[model samples]
Target: MSRIGYARVSTIDQDLETQIVKLKAEGCDIIRSEKVSGASRDGRAELATIIDFLRPGDELVVTRLDRLGRDTRDVLNLIYECEQKAAFVTVLDPHVSTRGEMGHIVLTVLGMVAQMERRFIKERQREGIEQAKRQGVYLGGKARLDHQKVKDMHEGGAGASEIARAVGCSRMQIYRILQSNR
Candidate 1:
């Protein structure tokens, strides 16, 4: 059976190098990676591809259980899918696998813990933001588009496509900006 690896990071700024190296050291024959949140299965094209391409006697490997998914239901669903294909999942950290009955139980518990951890993280983030807002120090994410610049460019005889390229935004954004100003 071939050992296939999967690695993921929640944001683009995070590096997958460490996970990749670990997977490679584990002797994974194939590895698929992506920069996307594991909080949900949506927008996870690499994960979908790996699942779809799984063979009957393969091993799906990940550095951590959370790398597969942080949601318990999603993680369980993924494991179930692998079982259906006669493939097993292997998590390096904590060394869990679905090849045995005990492994299945431990993985389920770990999946639940991971989901709870994600919830706790979100709760703490919300509390921190609220505290910062109370202290008048909270500022949301930085704006990527300048409305005034967009307006000026559009008024200066720039086409939607040209304004979009110049502003480093989409043509649809330019159209919306121009339409809003009209």
Candidate 2:
């Protein structure tokens, strides 16, 4: 049986090294990873590939249950899909697995807890932002894109592709900026 590791980070700024190290130490035969949110399965091509490539007796491993997914239904569906393929899942951090009936029960409860924790985190973040706004201290998050730079470049007759490269953003973003200024 092959132990295939899957690592994921919620954002591009987050590092995957920690998860990678744990999976490696766990003796994962192959590792697939991506920088994407685990809130849902969307935009997780690497994960989808691992699931599709799974064979009987294969093991899908991750550092934690949250790394698998933040949504309980998504996690359970992933586990079910792996099981349907005659494969199983191994959670390194919690040392959980879906190797037997008991494992399934444990993972189910853990999945619920992970989802609940995610909701709590979001609720807390929202509350903090609201408090900051009420105190007039919320200047809002810094813009990653320079709208002024984009405007100047576009006004200078630079094409969408040129502005995109110069601003280090997508052409779609450039188009939106230009359109909004019109």
Provide the clashing-pair count of each candidate structure: 0, 0
Indicate which candidate wins on lDDT.
Answer: 1
- Best candidate per TM-score, number? 2
lDDT of 1 at 172: 71
Q: Each candidate: RMSD to true structure?
A: 4.4, 3.1
| Cα lDDT tens digits for candidate 1, 1-182 | 89999999987558999999999999999999998789999989999999999999999999999999999999999999999999999999999999999999999999999999999999999999999999999998766688889899878888889988887766876888788878
For residues 1-182, write the lDDT of model 2, one tens digit per residue: 89999999986568999999999999999999988789999889999999999999999999999999999999999999999999999998778888878889999999999999999999999999999999999998877788989999988999999998887766877999989989
Q: What pairs collide in candidate 1?
A: none
Clashes of 2: 0
